[model samples]
Target: VQPSTFITHVAVLTQPSDGTAGRPLPRQPVVAAMDAGGNVMTTYTQPVSVKLNRGDLDSVGMVGTRTVTFRAGVGTFLDLRIDRAGCCLHLVFEVAFGLFRGFSEGFC
Candidate 1:
């Protein structure tokens, strides 16, 4: 377990990575956090979620996941299929603790 009030060191993009875009992208953006020790904290399992909000959560009409559980401190945005958003889409990963999160920009 992590110490209370400890800050996460980093957030890494595991899917929908940089320089990869496709119509109807059949993958979800995944973000993982690493402690100061640089190890995957599997015990950090917590319900994680994110969305492709363009100033509106439901603006895209199911283009991204609404919620997904985390495994080994990794949360995946399920059913994330983007094709009509054009470019420069944002993917935010929210951890269960409500203190740690990550963001990434991608194209579709």
Candidate 2:
């Protein structure tokens, strides 16, 4: 089935919080599929992947399970962390198929 027919986009339900370099954010990010009306599309289950929106040029990049298959339309990133020190960083979450996408708030 075509995903666009079911989910309009994805949203960051739980935003990542600032944390020490190389340590996982105390509040992990959680993404979910959403319909056009801003409701969770519980039936849409697919893989969701995350990456740093931007960071220091010399940073080691994001660590941990960067991609996860959704359960009941929700993707929970349990251990996401940046390897280098930075401020006001944002994480971008996108569907594995490269369709829907979402962004987390700034963090360090």
Candidate 3:
């Protein structure tokens, strides 16, 4: 991938969900992509394939929607099922357009 054709900035978002009995509170994993100049590209409407691990999974992104498209430069993965407490999320974003293999780590 060219230097100018890669995602320069990757951001992760985590939301704390109220816990219920016998379930891990699911949280949506949100990633933001930006250019080298740090400008968020809202026009990058592309379905980005992402793999998420060791994090919470919001019910919205579950069931065939683990891979999601970016809307307004932010892609929200609703199927993330986080494992364990005090562990950071590991995510890899690939394909779909204008982005290379980018890794983002976040603490929720």
The residue-by-residue lDDT of candidate 3 on 13-41, one tens digit each, is 44434333234446555766667866666
Compared with the true structure, model 2 gives a TM-score of: 0.88
lDDT of each: 0.56, 0.83, 0.55
Write candidate 1's Cα lDDT for 1-108 as tens digits: 553333373365655632333344555566665666665555676666665545533434334456676576666564566544445566666665557666666644
Q: How high is the lDDT of residue 29 in model 1?
A: 69
Which stretches of model 2 miss by more than 4 angstroms?
1-5, 55-60
Highest-scoring model, TM-score: 2
lDDT of 2 by residue, 1-108 (tens): 334447878899998988888898899999998887777877877889998875534464789999998888899999988888888788888885667789888877
lDDT of 1 at 47: 69
Ranking by TM-score: 2, 1, 3
Candidate 1 vs 3: which has more lDDT: 1
